[model samples]
Target: MRYAVALAVAMAGLQAMPAQGAGQRETGLEETLAQRCDAAAASPFDRDRPSGVPGVPSHEIDPAIAIPACMAAVRAAPEVPRLWYQLARADLAARRFDEFRDMAARAEALGHAGGAHALGQSHEAGHHGARDLAAARRLYEKAADAGFAPAMVDLGVMLEDGTGGTADVAAANAWYLKAAEAGEVAAMNLLGDNLVAGNGIGRDAALGARWYRRAADKGDGFAMASLGLLLELGNGVPRNMKEANAWYRKSAVAGNRRGMRLLALNLETGNGLERDPRGAVSWYKRAIEAGDVMSMRLISFSYFNGTGVPKDPQEGLYWLRKAAEAGDPAAMVTLGLRYTAGSNVPLDFERGLGWLRKAAEQGEPRAEAALAVLGDAPPGRSACRSVLGDYHALDARYGALPARFSGTLPAFRAVCAGFPGLKEDDVRRCHLLNPDGAGDFVRRVRKQCR
Candidate 1:
């Protein structure tokens, strides 16, 4: 990231001259001293020397002067690995990629401890020149072998995806473990994922949750979202919708799109809490604004059905089109329905059939039924009726019954007798279908039965 200098300046005291016997000896000594000085100046690991008075000669000089002095110092004392590293770093800063590589190679050959890591990072980033993943990997491995945890993590990532060599999940896991033990936040997240997914290790959801919690507590947004999802799904922990909601809220507030979507669903459905349609709409809007495709689909559904807000067919069609363009199967189906019904638009059989065919190709049942109906009027009607029967059957199993029907005493009696798995939360959500207490007759039956 450092800016490269375009020009080099000679030191005021050291002038270029023809080398004779004695003169060459003096020049070599002066060059060696200059190289040593430059090396010392370039070392980031060392404390910087105090600045000298203006116009005064000192160990620390402007880089233009310091570079030549350091070259001279290296000429005089060529065995110093630190000096070689300094020269290499200087060349790197000056955007002299080839020279930096050569100097770094020399520094490494001289057994410089830190230069390898820097060289690896530079190559990995392509900072001073062209990217060389192979070279970066080699140097990273060397540094990791030298007990550098950062290098171990970087090497692990490279190996995990086969960036510079063959994929080695086991090796990647080992390196991640090493870095995690050394307190690397990124490595901890990777290790947790590996453990959770059973990659290069046995699946241990509990252990994964523990690690995710640790990283989440440390402000890792991905970890927070991961942990929240597990809690919501009752994976590796007792299902606690309240805790899941809390965590989702945390991540959503922190700009997590998934969290925003889930929170919206929970609010809309009154899952594990009081229902808040307005709150649901707000969260859905946020998720949609954040570019969550599913959220856009849900928003379109809401508008189409007049759920939680006034119906706006135009808005519904607009969002449906957006979601369909994003390749959402459900959106394609909805679009096909809109075109077929001529809702807020002209009825176009061809357009409707085209959209239906697209959805049917993706195995959408409604689309398939629509396509069958369009093919042969009578047979299609029969096929559609059969499909509708199947669809309603599936809906009864997974979806809530309408509140109006459930509010009838006889209907309530039938449901309570037939479906023992219905929870209070499910019943409460059903009430929201009417959004009014007009369904209180059903409550009377329950109270009388009790």
Candidate 2:
């Protein structure tokens, strides 16, 4: 995650130079800070490496070497928080969980507070050998208490999810606010979502947009997606399809799956850009491979319609089945239709009814209508609840959303232009409006364009 990387880079800043000796030695803290800033400004993605590596290594290196260098540096200067933090990185990469924990402990003992926070992350990631969420929580709490920005986010996530603890939306919001105040970009996005959704916070679309923009500016992909959605739908900001597309493109280039899917749609339909079905297909494939259910559904549709790729009934059916199995309501409805029509698969009333029931339970109006046509009552509403449970299961296996943004216009523009049938007037009307209204608008756009 970008949040983790940014925190690591921040800690590295504190390690760039050795501290002063007791009496005569000069403290190079300021010089170290300047050097770190210069390096970060030059290339934010570059990871710090050992001096032993030749040829000015420009990219991230293997954790094995980096950890040792950090450990050696810490041995030479135990009080340096950066060295401890760097060592932890190496240990995490090398899968030396116990060592990382021990090193983090040592760093904390030596007054390197950030080390404690990094240690918590390692625990959460099950670095080294074993999973230990309790240990991670303890370390997260310790780091949060020590005023570390990332720790606040980490603690907030844990509380929000009730992972390794009880769910506490209030506590989560407090931690998110603290992290936001400390300039943690991901926390800003999370806080924005909470504000917009009225989850443990009063609804505030404008404030939500503001927070999303802050994270988007910092190159957070999800934030870019959220901001683009807001702008495109006119929620808390002026409706601007061009701006929305630009943000989507920005997020897509940064490896956001939803952005890629949206961008693909734009390419296929020429919403704000020139139509390019081949390019759209490429983007859609990428998103599908990354486990976006909507992408899967779109891919199936494309196959069925012979839009970008050659028409293949089998392929269409396969993708539709994949989406349905993954709990996509539209996919379930489509499958039901296919069964009812005896198209692409055998005509079986029992199977058709089963799929229709699944879709209807999830509140698919089409499925409900089809059931009515078949002289059957709509399935139980409990199916709607099951949809959310299924969504969580899928999200856990595949990442939920894009995690970073590139902050480029081409990227953003793609997302804005991708969703079809989005009128300029509709976009303008949703800006800075009520959250419920904004959400409804987004749903309308998604349903129509998708």
Provide the TM-score for each candidate, comma-separated: 0.52, 0.66
Tens digits of per-residue lDDT, candidate 1, 1-450, equal: 112231223333344545568967676766556444644455422212123412222223345544455555566567767566666656655556777777777777876644686678778878666789998999989977876666778899999999988889899999988877766667888888888899888898888888888877877666777787788777787788889888888878888777887777778768776887778878889988888887777776567657687888788778778887887666676666556545555766568667878878888665765455454333323322232222222222122223323332223323333333334654564454334432453353343323
Q: Give the runs in model 1 whose Cα sits over 4 Å from its true position.
A: 1-158, 288-291, 320-450
**Among all candidates shown, the one with the greatest TM-score:** 2
- Name the weakest run of 10 consecutive residues (lDDT summed) in model 1: 389-398
Candidates in order: C-alpha RMSD to true structure: 11.8, 12.7
Largest lDDT belongs to which candidate?
A: 2
lDDT of each: 0.64, 0.65
Q: Candidate 2 lDDT, tens digit per residue, 1-450? A: 433465466567555545557442333543343334222221111123234322211234355346434543554456555566556555655666787777777766765556777777777877666778888888888878877777888999999988878889889999999989877787998999998898988888889999999988978778888888788667788888799889889988888888888778777767677788888889889998777887887777677657799998789889879999999877787777566546567756578679879988998755665565543422332222122222222222122222211122122122233433444544443332222234554454445333
| Native-to-model Cα distance after best TM-score fit, residue 120 in candidate 1, in Å | 6.0
In model 2, the worst 10-residue window by lDDT is 403-412
